[model samples]
Target: MTQRTIKVGMLMAKESPDLISLVGYQTSASAVLIGLDRINAENLLPNINFTFTWYFDECQPYKTAGYLTKLILIDKVDVVFGPTCPEWKARKISGGIVL
Candidate 1:
């Protein structure tokens, strides 16, 4: 049997355009990817494969909402991660959307 690929939407604040790394393995989009990679490597979920789509929050509340909307409505992601800043969290969580 073939496993289904799961899409996880990630939102992160790009503080500086010159800064290539975000949070340096502490907590950020890259950190999420590392965790997912470990899960896949360990075969923890058995028949499910996880993949990611990312959006930059840019540390702005209003922009974050837009990114969230795109993730939930357009991308139709199965799960969402990042946008770590609670202030930037979207008010819309309806329509079976998981935040």
Candidate 2:
């Protein structure tokens, strides 16, 4: 079997002075990690491995675009998972219709 590694990029806020927001970010990150762990543990994709790189964009549109560009071009990620707040900008950056 040919082994392949899929690269994933995640855009999320990792630091916040506000306690509530910090907890939320931690929760979101934890959820993604847990899901990935489950998939890997179950051999969901045989002979495939998953790896991820994450960026803290603070949920800003401009930052999302910039970080996404880096993730795609520099990081060479096969998939991107976030930038939850500026949904429209992310869609546009990824060549998706905002409407």
Best candidate according to TM-score: 2
Please report, as a residue range, the 10-residue window in candidate 1 with the lowest summed lDDT.
17-26
Over the full model, what C-alpha lDDT does candidate 2 score relative to the true structure?
0.74
Question: Whole-model Cα lDDT per candidate?
Answer: 0.67, 0.74
In model 2, the runs with Cα more than 4 Å from the true position are: 17-25, 93-99
lDDT of 2 by residue, 1-99 (tens): 898999988777766555326434688778878987888788787888878888877767788888888888789888887765656866588544212
C-alpha RMSD of each candidate structure in angstroms = 4.2, 3.7
Instruction: State the displacement of the C-alpha of residue 70, model 2, in Å, after optimal TM-score superposition.
Output: 0.5
Q: Could you say which candidate leads in lDDT? A: 2
- Report how far residue 66 has shifted in candidate 1, in Å: 0.4
